[model samples]
Target: IAVMTVLLIVVGLTACGKSTAQDLQSNKWYPNQKGQSYKTQFNKKTMIIESPLMNVNANYSVSNTSGKEYLKVNTDDEKNQKLELTQISDGYKAKAINKPAKADDGLGSFE
Candidate 1:
């Protein structure tokens, strides 16, 4: 009886731990798909953004309506900004509605 109980517990745990490829694929979020969206909040001041084929960490909210995707970012030191990304044949094109102010801070660099 003890051996059978242990075997049953082990089997149950193993089953719970195993995830098939189909299960993994189903859980993945595809941003390019119409009506499909995702949101990630890192903290009160930071968030992780995901669009059809892009990902960025910022203080923003992302949404899609009528097959159009939009990204809105807000910062304490800067004015609120919004951008629209349109899916093209090859990739996405971004158009900013209100251009953000440039900062000389060395937070980012170009190689």
Candidate 2:
């Protein structure tokens, strides 16, 4: 019974898709800063980021640790832009995950 239940749960989760992806995809992520004109779209294995600072197609992966979601982005110009993002009342709170750089600067609860 326990094994069946676990299998069912796993199957359901897989069929529904990863919650992190769904949550990330539901909203059009953008920088909170005004006048910057930034828009980001998250897909299964990639994302499109458009802003004055950078405009490029990037590959990304979502992972959860300690109940926190971290997004890793890799662009042609940059690699492994990791960010620990938490959903806030207004937007999202984000910070550098590992080695900080310009790529991780684009995330936060600014708007």
Candidate 3:
């Protein structure tokens, strides 16, 4: 019984953690301040700006009248900083911008 309880607790915690992460990703935007622009198209008639340059490492799941889309900015240590762009229109456009990695004293890692 004790073992079962512990396992349940672990699974619950893991599930909660994943849920939190998804929420964060869905709403990740740093330069989320006012007046900055980050525009991506939802279709021919709709354009959405999930965040701004100030939103340095924000992730977002954008849904518009057309469809759903995802965006995430890369900021992991040991990896190059880049703007991870993703869009799915008639086809799709996905790419990254390469930039020099920053020094963080070896205490951080990118994912």
- Clashes within 3 Å, all models in order: 0, 1, 8
- Top model number, TM-score: 2
* Tens digit per residue, CA lDDT, model 3, 3-38: 999999999997676332243334422221134335
On lDDT, the stronger of 1 and 2 is 2
Cα lDDT of model 2 by residue, 5-79, tens digit: 999999988878747677777878775554554787878787887867666788888788888888777777667
Query: Which residue runs of candidate 2 sit more than 4 Å off their true CA positions?
Result: 1-18, 33-35, 52-54, 100-111
The residue-by-residue lDDT of candidate 1 on 1-111, one tens digit each, is 999999999999987862322232333333332344554333434545465576555575556679676655665544456667555554344456554622421111110
Better of 2 and 3 by lDDT: 2
Candidate 1: global Cα-lDDT?
Answer: 0.48
Candidates 1 and 3: which is better by TM-score?
1
Candidate 3: RMSD to truth:
14.1
Q: What TM-score would each prediction reach against the true structure?
A: 0.34, 0.64, 0.27
Ranking by lDDT: 2, 1, 3
